[model samples]
Structures are given as structure tokens and as C-alpha cells.
Target: MDVAASPTSGPATPAGPDSAWMLREAEQFIELFYGEGNGQGGPAARMAEIRAEVAGTGTYTHTVDELAFGARVAWRNSNRCIGRLYWRSLWVRDRRDISDAAGIGTESVKHLVEAGGGGRIRPTITVFAPDRPDAPGPHIHNEQLIRYAGYPQPDGTVLGDPRNVGVTELALRRGWRGAGTRFDVLPLVIETARDGIELFELPPEAVLEVELSHPRYPWFAGLGLRWHAVPVISAMNLEIGGIRYPAAPFNGWYMGTEIGARNLGDTDRYDLLPVVAAKMALDTSSNATLWRDRALVELNVAVLHSFDRAGVKITDHHTESNRFITHLEREEEAGRTCPTDWSWIVPPVSGSATLVFHRYYDDADLRPNYLRRECPVEGGPDRT
Candidate 1:
């Protein structure tokens, strides 16, 4: 059963470029698609059909092959991703016909189950209905499908993941209450014009999680640290050939530092360094002691160890960094310029040690990319 009534109609498509701009973007993308030898028909023929469709309906539909190719290339063009070495392996779930909240919720759960792949995590994406001139597509309120709820306490501390306080509060406003646990998975919030807003709780089978533990220190498990296995990013809009899929959710397997060095170790987030340091009996007296750095290394070690022990597919920063270099070389050999954001490509924990840290890259704003979506809920902080 659905948590809320499915909206019969979606919101009107948000204001964007005029028809001329759409046609121009469409022409460029179609040319690229055909140029890459991925198109079934001739480029000129496709463009002519696209032009006619735009003149009549303001937009054209992408063939299934075109959609899949475009999504793969988007990952290839993603400047910040370090795992683009396997971008072509991304499993695309095209659900362009599903615009209702209930259908989206169902498909999202299925996405988690399939993408999680029972610990052999697969890089995947689920593309939903795209925004059209007549109507907009559905919107996913959570930044990721499996984020923990953050309950703001009266003492000015957050009980759960502090980064999710805004989303947690938004869930509360919609009359959805979590179990009040630090690891309570927030409900999936879906919005459309006809239904306004709807909440759907993800089933446990769909949320595969790994408990954090250390191979060397047994005390690490006592911290009660755990994280969802699959990180399905749901808030970003995907643009292909000027068509906007506002509710596309995608995921890549976790990199160790993402969990240990940033999510858990960051001062604004879980801030587990001091706790880990105390557990390790490290002196927190001075900066010269490097207690925080030591603690961070151990934390990251625990993360990599835990995921490995759990039989989950996770990549360590060093290995992923090397793979990125290989991908860069491959792209260059293919006569393509690999656009990279050095700051993002470099791992957070050991910046200098990683191969990606030393190189400068072409940081171009390429089309057919994932974009930050405008927040649908007023006053809600953008999580991504």
C-alpha cells in the first residue's frame, strides 16, 4: 500500500529555456549521440524528427538506447566522480512512464534491492518521468534515499545525523515520525502538484546496512556506528538533450573516505574523532600530537575493514585513485578530454598521497549532466 494518495497530475514544468534554446541543446546532444555511433538512425534524420516534435509539442522523447547511452556518458562526463572507470557498467532503470508517487516509491525500493545486489553493489540509476512543457516531473525530497533522520534536541544538539536535520524536520511536518533512534532511516518524501507531498517508508529488505567495526580493536563495534550499503542520490536533476528528469536517483559503491573521513569524522556531522581518540587513549592536548589525524586514520581503517568483512563491495581511496588515473589515460587514448575537478577527485583523508591530488584537469561545464535541482519544499535546506 502507498503511504499517501498518488497525485493524478504533476506540477507545471518549472520555467526554463524557450523553444529555441531547447532545439539548440537538442541538436547538439543528438549530434553527439549520433557522432558517437550510438544512434540507430542518421543524425540529420533524427534532428529533423526532433525539430518537428519540438515545433508541435515543445519536446521530443529519447529512444531507450539513446537514454541509456546518454546516462552512461553523463557519468563519463561527471567531473567529481572517482569511480567513472566503470561508468559504462552503470545499470539504467528507465521508468519514464511512472509519474505517480506510489509507483516511484515502489520503483525506488526495487532500485535499492537490485542495486545493493546483496553486498555486491552495482553502480545504478533509476530515471523517472521528465519535466515537460505541460507538466513537471515528481521530486524526491531526501538527498539520498537512505539518510538517517536528525532530531533536533532542546540542548542544541542533533540526536541523529546533523546533516539531515532539515529533511528530518520536513518529515515531521508531514506527520511522519521516525523510531527516534540515531540510525532511523528517514521516510522517502515524494512531491507533485496534484498530491502536494507524500511520504513513503522504505522497507527493511530494501535498506541493506553495514555495521562498523575494527579488525584490530573490538571496541569499535561498541560505538554503534553503521551506514547504509547503497547511497542512492535522489535529489539531482538529470538533463539530456534539453529534457529534464528531475527525479532521477543514482548510486555508486561507497569509497572508504566518504564514510570515515567525511561523514563520520567531520566536525559538523557525526564528529566521531574525539570519541575514537578517547577509545584509543590518545592525548587530545595539542595540535602537534596529531591525535585527530591518528584517530581519522583508524576510523578510515575501520570503515574499509568493516565493509570488506561484511562481504560488501567497497573501494579504498588509494585503489580508486589509481583507477581514476587509468580512466583518465583511457579517455585520452580515445581522443577525449577527461574533465575532472581535482579537489573532488582527490580523496579527503590522504590528499597528498593519492595520485589524483597532483594533477590538474579540464573542468568544463558539459551538457547532458546531473544538475542540482531547485528545492520544492520552502525553507528546507538543500541536503546535496
Candidate 2:
């Protein structure tokens, strides 16, 4: 319900049944959210208690405000969720012709709605729930899309709980890509392999696909990053650890598109999502053999799925490691040298996996060459 301020100056106290009911409602709401078997208290009953307590304190007039605050606290506490979605847009401002940019925010979101190919993004919202069964061709741009993130509150606001980061800052960091005021909205998608918690995007398009492989039997231990076209630069590429990786070809699983126009005449506004795919790397300090001390490589790829200029379909993409491996394999087949003992560090929270580097070659004269020496060096064993 839309919250409204009360006319009375002082707070109003809740009565016997009234106060009890409110508390019950709150508790029930919590139950529906976190799902059953989550070990949380019942929703209907809990709301009653909160109502009675507030009434006893004589702060009933502020019920609306309290309810809003309580709802947020309730959601955060029970859901274990964080983050938000944001949006803004750039348009040529002919101050001489029109002096307002009131509809830009609405328009930006509209584009994503019409595009409509970002998985369950546009269709599953509660607002659009009724129209689902027999709805004719795409009706009123569905506004039901939900956004979530790792952090619930903003930076200045305290997030005493450390499960996630500040929602506002995450939104702003990405929202800056869009011009004008930022809205608190997020995309609804869950990255698997990682916990199936709903993820939030700062006004992302539709589908974001991120993959990080370590080239080993258990391949979940690498750190890689992925990107779709932001609202700025036309084409983009990624360079990490002195290695350059190619963008997904023809937008394979993750398509490509034209970066959006610039804002404030900066010509540098681009939109993209950068996620730190959490994972734990191998711990080798305990052993003394080469296998024990080998450095672990970590790869994380996060795709901030959103919309392209055309607003026709959801974009898809893969992380850099896959692209790098494809290139490395080709080079080896051509008798070119490559690196060895490659390892990745997957964060512990997200689970663990490993990437093994097997093939070794030698070609010191070539640029960007990482060859493994076969014979020992002047003072020690071969260290190519």
C-alpha cells in the first residue's frame, strides 16, 4: 500500500484487535517471502505482537512510516537479499524548445519492456500477473520486473549485517551510465553454480551470462569477467593479466550491440555490469612439492544483462577465460608457445574448483610468449 502521512501531530496507538492484526500480517508477510522450511517465525502471528508493542509505546499515529520501515527490515532480515536496479537516459535537450526531462526515466524502462526477451524479466512481475493468461499482443509495458542486489541500504546508511553491500552505491555506480536521476529498480535473475539467490543489476538489459573455466576436472576455481555493450563506447574488449580476450563471437550466448549515447555531452557514458564472482582458490602453503606451491588462478565472469539501442531482444555473453583458451589452443596447434601450471582462485563463498595448465612450449624470441623450458638453467632446473 502507498504510505501517507497522518494529519494528527502525535502518534496514534493501536487497539486490542487492531494492533494484534498488524503484527500478525507482518509475520505472515515474512513467511511468504523466505519460503517455507527456512526456519523463520510465522508471519500472521508476528505482526500482532509488533502492533501491540508499538501501541504500548504510544507511537500509533506513525503506523504508516513504521510499517514501511518494518517491511524493509522484515524483507532484509528474512530474505537474506540485497541490491537494487536503476535507470536514466540521455536525450538532446533543446532548452529553447522544451525545458523539462520529466519522462526520460519512464522512457528508458519502456525500452526494456518492449524488447521483452530477457528470460522471465518482463513477464513475471506481480503488477502484470493478471494479464498473463489471455493477454493480447504485448500490452501496457509490463512494470513488474523486480531488481535485487548484494547490499540492501546505501553507503551512508548503515548495513550492520555483512551478508551484502550497500544497495544505493551499487545502483549509483552503474546508474551513472544512464543520465539523470537514478531509480531503485533491479533485474530478476539467479546465477547458478553460485547460490540461487536473486541477483540485482543497475538497470541491466535482459540476460547476463558469465562463465569462468580453469581447464581442469573440477573447473570452478577461476576468476573471469564478462561485459555486454555499455551505454557509451561502440565496441569493447577486455585485457587482464597482460592477456587480451575477444568479445563473444556474434554475441553467441551473449550478443553484442551499439553502446548508448553519451550524457552531459561527455561522449564517454557507457553501460555495463562488473561482478566479482566469489570463489576460493587452492591453498598450497602446507605442502613443499611443486604441486603444493603452484599459484592458483581465479576467474569470475558477471554479465549485467540489459537492453541494446534497438530494444528488441535480451543480450548474452561469456567470460574471458573461454575466449582465451580458444585462442591458446589455436596457437599451440600452430606450434606456438603457451604458459604452463595455470591455476585460478575461486572464492570460498561461491564454492571451489580448479584449472590445470598442462601443455608447455618454448619460444623466447616471440612477443607475448610464455614458454616452459625443458632443460635446467645456468644455476637451477629449467625454468622456461
Which candidate number maximizes TM-score?
1
Model 2, span 1-384: residue lDDT tens: 000000001111122324344444444444433342332465455445545755685212212323233222221121101100100111111111111122222332443333234432221110111011122111111011221122333454322112112332333454422122222233322111223222233245432322323333242323322222211110111111111111100011112211111110111211111111113344434455332113221221112222322233332212222333464466468553443222211111111221212333231221111111111111111100
Kindly give the number of clashing pairs for every candidate. Answer: 0, 60
Q: Which stretches of candidate 2 lie over 4 Å from their true place?
A: 1-148, 152-167, 170-327, 335-341, 345-384
Compare the candidates by lDDT and give the number of the best one: 1
lDDT, candidate 1, residue 137? 88
> 1-384, model 1: which lDDT tens digit per residue?
000000111122247768888888788888889888886768899988888998999888999988998888877877777888887887999999999999999999999999999999988889999888888889998878888888889999889889888878888998998899889999999997668689999999999999999999999999999988887888777788888888888888888888888779988789899999999999999989999999999999998899899999888889988998999999999998787877677778888998988878887767677766556543232212
Segments of candidate 1 deviating more than 4 angstroms: 1-14, 376-384
Q: TM-score, each model?
A: 0.94, 0.20
RMSD of 1: 5.2
